[model samples]
Target chain A: MAGTDPIHQFVISDIVELFTIGGDGTEGSGLTFSFTNSGLFMVVSVVLTTTFLLFASRNRKLVPDRWQLAGEMSYTFIANMLRSSAGSEGMRFFPFVFSMFAFVLVGNMLGMFPYFFTYTSHIIVTFGLAMTVILVVTIYGFARHGLKFFKLFAPSGVPAYVLPIVIPIEIVSFLSRPISLSVRLFGNVLAGHITLKVFTGFVVSLGALGALGWLGALLPMIMAVAITALEVLVSAVQAYVFAVLTSMYLNDAVHPSH
Target chain B: MVTQAFAQEAETPTEQNLDAAIDATRGEPVEGAVGHDPTADTHATTEAHGGEHDSGVFPPFDPATFPSQLLWLAITFGALYLLMSKLALPRIGGILENRKHIIDADLAAADASRQKTDAAIAAYETALAEAKSKAQGIADQNRETIQADLAAKRSAVEADLGAKLSAAEARIASTKAEAMTHVDEIATETAQTVVTQLVGDVSTDSVRAAVAKAKE
Candidate 1:
C-alpha cells in the first residue's frame, strides 16, 4: 500500500549511497556524497536540455527542420516573452531567463515518466530559481538606478500623507513575489502529480477486490489518464508562467518606476 | 513479499481469504530484519506507510537532501547560463545574420542585373533608330544628286543640237547664193545667143541691166 500510495511517488530515495572522506562510511556522516533519484532526474533534465539545444542548432539552416524549428520556437518564445514584458533592454538577461525556462520545462516534462521524479514539484528547486531571479533583478535594479530603485516601494501616484502605509504594503508585496512565484509552480506540479498517483492507486486497489472491483477500477484508470493529460498541459503552462513572471520582474528592475 | 501476496490473492477466489492473508502479512517480522539490511528497512518502512501516508510526505522540506539538491541545481543552472550566453544564443544570432546577408546580396545583384538589362535595351533601341535615320538621309541626298546630274546633261545636249543646226542653216544659205549667181550668167548667155540667131546679135549690156532689175 505504501508503494502504491500517491504521496510516495514524490519521495527522494537514494540511488547510490556514497561515502565521505573518512570515518565510518554511512549516510549522515562527515560529508554526504549521496546521489538521490531527485538529483538523477535533475541531471537528466539538464542533459536533455543541453542535447536538444546543442544538436538542434548544429546544422543551423536558414530553413529549419522539425527539431530545429522546435529549438528556434523555444528560443523565440522566450525572446518574444522578454520583449513584451521587459522590452528590448530586458533581453540582456536572456541567458538567465532561457536557462530557467528550459530547466523547469524539461523537469516538468520528464516527471511525466512513471518512475521519474519531478524536481520542479519540489519547493526547494522552485524557490532556488525564484530567489535567483529576484536576486538578479534586485542587483540589476540597484546597479542601474541606485537609490531610485527604492522608489518602487513608494509609487509615484501615492498621496504624501499615505506614504507610510502604502510604502510598507508595497514593500511586503514586492517581497512576496518570489514566494508566490515559486509556490505557484511547486504547488501545481505537486498537486497534479499527487492526483495522478492517487487515481493510479485506485486502479490497482480496486482491481484487487474482484470481478466487481475490476469493472469499477476502469473509472479511476480513465480519470488517471485524463489527469495525466491535464498535467501535461499544466506542466507546459507553468513553465511559461515562470518565464513570463521572471521577465516581468526583470522589467521592474530595468525600469524601477511606478 | 508484496508480489507473493498479490499472487496468492489472485489464486484465492474469496475476498475474506485475501483480507486475512493481507492482515497476516502486515504483522510479519520485516522490521526486525531491517537491521541486517538497510534496503530492507526502507522497503519495510515503505510497506508500513501504505495505510498511513505520513513517512514521505513532502521531499522538498526534507533537510537531509536540500544541500545536495541546492548544490547541483546551482552548478547546473550556472553552467546552463554560461553555455547559453557564450555559445547557443550567439550561434543562432550568427546563422540569422548570415541568412540576412545572403538575402541582401542576392537582392542587390538582381537589381544590378536588371539595370544592366535596361541599359542594354535602351542602347539597342537608340542604335536602331540612328541607323534608320541615317539611311533615310542618304536616300534623300542620292535622289537630289541624281536629279541635278540629269539636268546638267540635258542642258549640254540642247547647246550641242543648237550649234549643229546653225552651221547646217549657214551652209544652205551660201550654196543658194552661188547657184543664184550662176543662174544669172547662164540666163544672159542664152538670151544673147537667141537674139543673135533671131536678128543679128542683141546688146550684152542691155541684157545684163534687165537681169539685174528683175533680181532686185
Candidate 2:
C-alpha cells in the first residue's frame, strides 16, 4: 500500500499543546482534545500499565511474584531517579515527572508496532511536551527567584565588558532548549522507524536466492528484529532522559548559580 | 448434617496446633476425647454461623473493577503489612516461646540428673570404705591366733631338744672310754701275738727286751 505524505503525516502546524491541566495560555490545541490516533495510543498505554499493575498487585504475597517484583522495581527506580535529579527540595513535582515518564514510555512503545504512527516522530507533539516542561521550570523559576532568573543566562566568570557579547549567546543557547529537546526525540524515533522500513523492504523485494542474495535479505531481517528490541530500550531511555532534563531545568530554576 | 460436622471437625494440620493451644487455655476438653465438638471452636464457629452478617454486606463490591488498580495496589500492600502484624507474626512468636520453654525444662532435668549422680557416687564410696575396714579387722584377729600358736610350738620343741642333747653327751662319753680301753687291749694283744709269731723258742727275758725295743 502507498504511504501517506511524510511531510503532512508527521509535521507540526499549530504551536501549543499539553496532557496535564496547568495554568497556561494554550492547553490541548492540536491532538490532546479528540479521539485521534495519538490519543488512542495514549489510552492504550495507560490501559496496559494499569492492567499490568493490577495483575501484579492481586496476589499480595510477601514474596512477590515475577510481575509484582517488576512493578515494585519500576516504582522504586522512578522514585529514586526523581530523588536524585530533583532532590528533596522539589518532591511535589514527582507525580508530574512520573506522569510524563509514563506518557512518553507508552508513546514510544505504541509507535514501534508496524503500520503505526510514532507520536514522538511528530515535532509538534515533542515540542509541545518539551515546552510544557520548560514552561513549568520557567514559571517556577521566576516565581521562586523573581527577576534573578535572568542571571541564568549570565555567568560570574565573564568580565563586565564581555556581558554585551556573552549574554546574547547564552540567552540563545538557553532558549534553544525546546527545539533541541523536540528535535532529538523526533529525529531518533523517525530515523529508527524509516531505517527499519527500508531494511524490511529489502527482505520482501529480494527474491529467494543464493549465498550473496540470501545474505542481502538475511542481514536486513536480523537488523529489523534487533532494531525492534533496541527501540524498546531506547523508548524507556528517552523517557528517562526527558524526565532527567526536566529535573535539571527545575534545579536550575530553583537554584540559579549564574 | 453429621457428616458435615465431622468433616469440619477434621481441621487442617496448620490450624490444629493453634486450635489446641486456644482450647487448653479456654478450659475446653482436648480434641479426639469423648466430648470433642466442632461447634466448640469459637473463631471458626463464628465465621461459619455468621449471625451478624447482613445480605447487604459489601454492597459496593465490584468484580469487574474500575481503573483503581493502582489504588487497590496501595491498599493491598497496607493490608498485607497489617496481616503480618496481627496474625502471622503473633503465631510465629508463640511457637518460638514454646521452643524456649521446652529447652529450659530439658536443662533443668539435666541438672537434676547430675545431682543424683553425685549422691550415688558418695554412697558407693562410703560402702567401699566400710568393706575395707571390716577386712582389715578380720586379718588382725587371725594374725593374733597364729602368733600365739607359733610361740607354743617353738617352746615345746626347745624342751624336747634339751633332753636329746644330754642323752647324746652321755653316749659320747661312754663311747670314748670304751674306745680308749679297746685301744689299750688291742695294743697289748697285738704285742703278745707279734712276739709269739716273731720268736717262738726265745726266752722270756729276751722277748721282753725285744718288745720293749719295739715299743720304743
Find the candidate with the highest TM-score and give its number: 1
By summed lDDT, the worst window of 10 consecutive residues in model 1 chain A runs over A25-34
- Cα lDDT tens digits for candidate 1, B1-216: 444444444465465643443443554433322233233333445454442212333656766566667777887788878888888877766776787899999999999999999999999999999999999999999999999999999989989989988998889989999898999989888877887888886689888787788778
Q: What is the C-alpha lDDT of each candidate?
A: 0.81, 0.61
Give the residue spans of candidate 1 off by over 4 A.
Answer: A17-33, A157-162, B1-57, B107-216
Please provide, for model 2 over B1-216, each residue's C-alpha lDDT reduced to its tens digit, 9 standing for 90 to 100.
Answer: 233433455554336644653553355655553224433443343334332111221211211111122222224323433443344323333444555687899999999999999999999999999999999999999998999999999889988899899899999999998997676566656666787798664455655556566657
lDDT against true structure, model 2: 0.61
Q: In every candidate, what fraction of the native interface contacts is reproduced?
A: 0.48, 0.00
Interface RMSD of each: 4.1, 20.3
Give one digit per residue, the lDDT tens place, for model 2 in A50-130: 556556555654556787667556555666786787677766565556556666676788887776646666555667678
**In model 2, which runs have C-alpha deviations exceeding 4 angstroms?**
A3-34, A54-63, A156-162, A208-215, B1-216
Q: Which 10-residue window of candidate 2 chain A scores lowest in summed lDDT?
A: A11-20
